[model samples]
Every structure is written in structure tokens, then in C-alpha cells.
Target: MSKEYLDGIIRRSLEIRNKYHELERLHHGSEWTVEEDALAYLTDAGLVGRNIMSQQQRWPKAGSQTELEHKLGENIWWLIVLAKRSGIDIKDAVNNFLTETEAILK
Candidate 1:
């Protein structure tokens, strides 16, 4: 992806994270720790996986496709959130991963 696209994603993720933190503060009175955020990311990922499985099996309920798409977006948002919380630049990490994997394949 282009730098602009990646930067846009990062900027949007920060906005979402701020909004989510505010919501959490209203309900829970505090921001979550890095570990808690990581757990939330994993939970969302698992829900996405389950939804994918349901779709593949043709056993999806009403609006399952929409729910799947929503969850996929949530999963990506949480990934960026977790990366930020852990002080990692997700774009750089992804680029490094691609480079390493390509080198291994070569």
C-alpha cells in the first residue's frame, strides 16, 4: 500500500482508539492495559474466524455476512490499537515481515 493509505489507516485507528477509550472510561472508569487490549484483539480475531467458518459452512444466520465484515474491520482496528499500545509501528513491522518471508522463500 502507499504511504498515504497506511498513514490514513493509522490516523483512523488512533481516532477509533480514542473514542473507544472514552466509552470504556464511561463504563469501566479506566483505560485498559496493553495486555487487556491484546486480549480484546484476540477475542475479536476469534469472532472473525468463527464468522468465516459459519459462512463457509453455509450455516450463517441472517446478516452474517455483514457481521463478518464488521468484525473483520474491528479486528484490523484492534491490531493497530495493540501495535500502538506496544509502541510498534505496524507499517514498518508489516514491511519487515514481508521482507523476511520473501527472503526465506528465495
Candidate 2:
């Protein structure tokens, strides 16, 4: 996907996470729903389901596909938060790793 789209997904990831935190505060972490639980731990069924269906002829249900994409962004958001918290710069890391990997391959 395009960087712009990726940025938007990343934005959404943080947004949902912030909402979850708010819910926890409002309910003392006792009033969340099952769906919320899905987002809480990044239990992205869509991604997993896709893998299951990949080898099959038919596609996964549309709704399941949507959930997968949503979860993908949310998971990435979590990664962004963790990296920021740990002062890990993924961009630089990716560049350094790419060079090392390429050298090894060559």
C-alpha cells in the first residue's frame, strides 16, 4: 500500500488504542465488550482467517476480510507505540538491516 494509506492506518491504530484506554478509565476496566477485547489484544481474526483460506478456492467472508484489515492497522499502531516508548526507530533499523541483508545475499 501507499505510504499515505499506511500513515492513515497507523493513525487509526493509535486512535482505537486511545479509545480503549478511555473505556478502561470510565469503567475501571470492567465494562468492556467482547469486540473491545478483540482490539485489546490485537486478535485480528481477518489476518488469521485469510491465511486459512489462502489455500482454498473460495474467499473468506467480506466482513471477516474487513476485520482483518482493521486489525492489521491496529496492530501496527501498537508497534508504533511500543517503538516510540522504547525509543526504537524502525525506519533507521530497516535501512541498516536492508544493507546488511543485501550484502549477505550478494
Q: Specify the poorest-scoring 10-residue window by lDDT in model 1.
A: 57-66
Tens-digit lDDT track for model 1 on 1-106?
A: 7899989999998998999889989999998888888888889888888888888875656666788999998988888888888889988888899999999999
TM-score of each: 0.90, 0.49
Error of 1 at 90 (Å): 0.3
The alpha-carbon deviation from the true structure for residue 70 of candidate 2, after best TM-score superposition, in angstroms, is 1.7
Whole-model lDDT for model 1 versus the true structure? 0.87
Q: In order, what is each prediction's RMSD in angstroms?
A: 1.4, 5.6
**Candidate 2 ranges beyond 4 A from true positions:** 1-19, 29-42, 45-62
* Candidate that scores best on TM-score: 1
lDDT of 2 at 55: 33
lDDT tens digits, residues 1-106, model 2?
Answer: 7778766765665577678779887979564554555465455444655644643526745565556566665556666655444577655655799999999999
